[model samples]
Target: MIGKRLKRLSPAIGRAYIQLIMELDERISEISATQLQKQLKCGPGCDGCCIQFSVLPLEAAIVAEAAVAKNVNAENNGESCSLLKDGLCSVYEVRPVICRTQGLPLAYIDEEAGAIEVSACPVNFPDDYPLSHDELMFMDSYNGRLAQLNVQYCTENDIDCSVRIPLADCVC
Candidate 1:
């Protein structure tokens, strides 16, 4: 299937992506990190957000760059995401900002002022469990980032570049 316009950005474009990613990551990490409060130790194998997601060009590029840097076999392995080697994101270090900011509830920056209430995915917790307040906060923030990042990438690349599909459907 011939996909949408593959926006070919310049080096500046790549840097912009990395910058946005880094900034977003830093802010979220500051907030969510405090909220998580060492919940990670109890969250082993808890990849609740990985299976149900898609990414923007900037995001895809970030993942591709990481795969290249780490020498991940993409042509043969990208079908399921190079990061998904052991049914999980292998390159977590260079994982997209969304991956870094998943599974939390949040009060996001309102267009007006301060923060507002938001909800998290019910499935963030195990089937027999429910997400904690911190988890829900993180999930809202993560989804907001997903929406904003795609818009920025599209604007920079001179295209709408907005399409919601399976994660497997997206490609560079």
Candidate 2:
């Protein structure tokens, strides 16, 4: 299932897939934001979860292109994300995949434990509102699809496949 259409994708098609994935993630985030607005503390000025994190190489590559176009630096200061400027994400328009999931109910299927681990920021879920597993955003499926797309991208571009780079490293 992974490599069925490996080399069939052109860079243009790969870019389209990346855009579609980003749109889907944004749509899901919007749903969560609307449904849990009362319980969610995340807002424009909230950078609580904007700490350093890694993103897939494909994400980094895309963001790197944006960084150059925007004339913004993507350096890592070994503190908070270098993208933050004046308490806001400088590259918010092209933020990485992990940045899109902050302050949302996220679920991960642990195969070894055979259970779905669900969690969100402590500020969320204060009202004991029951959220079904299907209601939460699942990372496994998203990540798998991303990996598949990344494989196609790498294959088409002759880049290394299956690599995760620090967000800072990707830009500069």
Model 1, 27-101: lDDT tens digits are 666655774554433244665456545666656655555555666642234344434656567567767665665
Where does candidate 2 clash, by residue pair?
none
Name the weakest run of 10 consecutive residues (lDDT summed) in model 2. Answer: 1-10
Write model 2 residue lDDT over 1-172, tens digit each, in one string.
1111123456675577667677767767666656566766777879878877777656766666666667777655457887777678887877866787777788899999999888777676654768765567777877777788777677766767866666666454
Quote the positional error of residue 53 for candidate 2 in Å. 2.0
* TM-score per candidate: 0.56, 0.78
Quantify all predictions' global Cα lDDT against the true fold.
0.54, 0.69
Model 1: worst 10 consecutive residues (lDDT sum): 1-10
RMSD each, Å: 5.7, 5.8
Question: How many angstroms is residue 34 displaced in model 1 relative to the true structure, after the best TM-score fit?
Answer: 2.8
What clash count goes with each model? Answer: 10, 0
Model 2 accuracy (lDDT, Cα) = 0.69
